[model samples]
Target: MSLLSPKVPALNDPVLVNEWMAVATAADISKPTRVSVLGEDLVVWRSSTGVHAFRDLCIHRGTALSLGKVSDDQLVCPYHGWHFNGEGQCTLIPAQPNMPIPTKAKAFSYPCEEKYGLIWVSLGSPAHGVPEFMEADDQAFHTIICGPYIVNAEAPRVIENFLDVSHLMWVHEGFLGVPEHSVIPEYHVHEREGKLVTDTITVFQPDPDGRGKDVNNDYVYQVLRPLTVQFTKTDDQGSDVFAIMLHTTPLAHRKTMAYAVLTRNYGFELDDKQFSDFQDKIFSQDETILLSQRPEELPLDLAAELHIKSDRLAIAYRKWLRDLGVEVGVA
Candidate 1:
């Protein structure tokens, strides 16, 4: 395909375009919010029916529809007062009241849905639905939405960072790990029904929970989607279980947004704010390192970067993305 070919935009590789990426939290779209996904600008909004996502462009005069107000379940264009409904249909043209609206006056739209308290958008036909967060189904777990953290890095880099366990001892320090037990145990990672799952990864944490005691923690990781990953962590006693589902959206080649769903069986007595705050602090630490990374885009080639035994999961993740032919945020 030529560089000028409209059929193949630089960032619209099918492997990524066909995958669903979380654009915003459900509460973030109370109004017409502009979002960038797969290098395309999008406007996401909520209607009485459900959440809707459309290209941020208004076809009339090439104006941004996000600058317009949404009224009577229609997104009005700020340029010429064209009203578009949730289905991307132009219903009214204020300039010529009696004139029939042209079928081609519609705004380009994409498939979107709300799940796990977040809004997801797909630029092309989705190969699969939103990745499952099974903890949401269990009533015993207390669910907390963590963040929509913006990182100056590629989407795959964000996902790889979430799946990385060796960084805990160095980056998270006393909270998630300790220097005395920094050596990571050899772990197993394999594919199951198209999803990558890792065997139990053990780590010693100075404070695994609010209890403030050191204990060995066990974690099992899963690659839910190209840009979505999850991990379940438990203590040696198996009494406490906490899980996090991380969703990443590639806003552009070097920018990304991440949202996390945290679920725990315990911590019911504790305020949800405490958990949210802790996660915020952890991500803050990660953001600094993520931004300082030399090459912002993740390297898909296995030999591009040296790997240690502890990096097995990250290795599998990169290979999966390479095999999938992801083109938006990698070398």
Candidate 2:
């Protein structure tokens, strides 16, 4: 089947779009990590000097380079004694004692950067820099790094959920969402700098019942392509907004490895333990639903079939992708 057919988007192709991959925690060749972005197998690891990313497959025998070892800032293939450096250059060859290793034996390389406790890889030429923690510099609030999660759905679908606010009453009722008795919220969608930003604000009037008191909250989501989302929540008493940024890199046509960072801005004492606990609860809730979704891309021309006021954000997002010259599947 064609890659971009109605049933599936061309997620594997390198020309589609770029995505963020993983975080850099430690430096050891014995610890090899595999990441999939744009349907390509990316092998990320730390050498003695810094981090490096290369195509996972070895050039000589086609063994996974990620399964190899790191020795003296060079990746040594486990199958054959071929060594490659950070620039994907073949530096050493055990079989050839006198002959210099041919350049053809080198592996394919990708651009990777280590920042904000994460390792980011670019599948395409990304003009915008790697996603940063905006709240980290604010002294009024503490910052936390919420570890990554692997979601089953596509990156766009996962981001749509973060942009959705109407679902709060039903999906996250008891935990973070308002009750059914609360007034329905007002929503607005805007575009800024080739990106779509959504804001949903609801004010909780003084209610006779205490259940609806905390319903007065505002949720704002900013979608920054090719896969970064910022979620902010503001309220009356000492505003606390957490920015959940997601970087989804495609593993295949049906799977993705999603790297997420939750940056919190609480104008009070918020320690690591408290922030970690909060993130754990919220992410655990989201994981259950996202992982259960059908492992397939939604029809590209969904606008022709279903239409709703709440779908405005979804439509705008699809349009933004289309505007970037990405091929939207046929109806």
Candidate 3:
């Protein structure tokens, strides 16, 4: 719940897909739950066989399968008592128990995998495998999954904002940056094989907790898809290496839910609550700024907005989305 009313983005165009997006946390889908993957309505659940994802609409009457319940190891539609198997095959219809289930009674099943406590779903056949974040599996690194922060902004805007380092000084002062060091130092941008990367950016910034002296660290932001961005930080700090991931589950054209996972080489002594609170604070700043952005959607036109040298990566990101023919929330 929020003090300000939330704005749900309107679904006006078809969503595109390339990356395997995290649709739900594994724990959240212990039972059946409705989710949207690249704008496709889905119902994800955990069964004895494993995790399964199906088009939420029932083959019979188009009722949302999510409104149904799990029964006898299968998803049962509430309206008609139709039971579906893990493979989305309608195995039993209480109204017609003696009749054999037809092949056409099956629902569409999508590709799904779980990693880092998240359920990753692909709207299309994925060419790339499920993504891995740094230090998530390392015993030495202390990691914490931070959020499902709901942001009332376009999915692409969330990615562009995460890739944008220049906003730190103005939008995240005192925590992520200070106005005194707002001048962005020269850095290179690289794009190849469907990934846009920043060339080792260094900025004088404060620790996210607003404690101790500031540390100047090098950053690497990787734009893996139209709506996924990640960054790594390294410096003479508590953590030998720090990594952050920003992934958005697009519920609609301009509405999204953001999730962040952080892996740190240090912070073994830090309490999870304290660490999570700090992360919440930092992300709240971004959420406030992003929701207020003009046009509400991300513009694919490079000329839509003025760009500084620091925004070279943002420009490259727009081009990537354009090349991929993404239209949802895109100009």
- TM-score to true structure, per model: 0.93, 0.79, 0.89
lDDT of 2 by residue, 1-331 (tens): 3211111223643334554555343332246687666566668877776778887888787788878888888888888878988898889888886897775877777778876567777755666677655665556545445655566666666665666655665556665655653444556679987667786655342321112245355566777774567766666663545556666655555455555565656434435665566556656666677667553454456645465776677677666665565431111
Error of 2 at 203 (Å): 6.5
Q: Write down the lDDT of every candidate, Cα atoms only.
A: 0.85, 0.62, 0.78
Clash number for model 3? 0
Give the winner by lDDT: 1
Ranking by lDDT: 1, 3, 2
Which segments of model 2 are wrong by more than 4 Å? Answer: 1-10, 13-15, 22-30, 137-141, 181-184, 203-215, 267-274, 277-280, 287-296, 299-307, 325-331
| Segments in model 1 whose C-alpha atoms lie over 4 Å from true places | 1-10, 209-213
> Pairing residues by index, what is the TM-score of model 1?
0.93
281, model 3: CA deviation in Å? 1.4
Checking candidate 2 for backbone clashes, the offending pairs are 23-118, 23-119
How many angstroms is residue 274 displaced in model 2 relative to the true structure, after the best TM-score fit? 4.7
Per-residue lDDT over 130-204 for candidate 1, one digit per residue giving the tens place of the 0 to 100 score? 999888768988887988888888888888888999999989899899777889888889999899999999999
Q: How accurate is candidate 1 locally (lDDT)?
A: 0.85
lDDT of 3 by residue, 1-331 (tens): 2111221223433334545778888888867899886556788987887788887878778888888888788998878999988888889989999998876787677788878778888766577777656567787777777788877888888888888899988888876788999988888788866678888888777875434557887888888766667898887553567788778877865778888888877767767787778888888888888878899888887788887888888888888888887777777
List of clashing residue pairs for candidate 1: none
